[model samples]
Target: MDSGFDLVSGGTDNHLSLVDLRKANVTGKDLEKKLDEVNITVNKNTIPGDPQSPFVTSGIRVGTPAATTRGFVEEDMKVIGGLIWETATAFDTKAGEIRAKVAELCAKYPLYE
Candidate 1:
């Protein structure tokens, strides 16, 4: 909420958040690609005042409830945050490395094991 992102509902009191990306100037489609390249799943969504189509929304919705339910703690959340920020800033060069790291983290808390 403090990162200047126009978060829906002013901010989240739950696991999910809607991020308005007009300031980032990157559509949700582009941002979604970046996150997916690193194995992070997210969905594009519309926010208040969004001027883009739903399929190419100007916002992205992200959440951590699944990871948390799988035993990921705050430190893991922090790492995920860094990965996401890295994606936002420099995903083209870091996709492979970030994906590897995400795999490693997920392996540590295997969901099916």
Candidate 2:
């Protein structure tokens, strides 16, 4: 059975996708930490062929359109990128601070009217 979710060439139909942690050496936990630092919210996902539980997957999926709609541009992406690097590099030391920052960012660019 083939779901339409899969592309014609057997690829996934998505604009942005996450690489598997086992293949990339970066875990979803680490990715979440880094994204938080820059106020980028993301959800962890299971690898395409993995049998692991979805709640504890090894990949992080990112969507940029939401941020863009909230007025984020390329320059903002640079700032977010830096923060992601820092948070991932120092997860334990930065989680709390990053959470607060994420909250602030959301307030600045609320999702709904």
Return the TM-score for each candidate structure.
0.82, 0.53
Scored by TM-score, the top model is 1
**lDDT, candidate 2, 18-90, per-residue tens:** 5454433456766765675555787777777654567666666656778888887666655554455445555
List residue ranges in candidate 2 displaced over 4 A.
Answer: 1-15, 19-26, 29-39, 47-55, 100-113
Evaluate model 1: give its lDDT: 0.82
94-113: candidate 1 lDDT, tens digit per residue = 88888999999999999886
- Model 1, stretches more than 4 Å misplaced? 1-6
RMSD, candidate 1, Å: 2.1
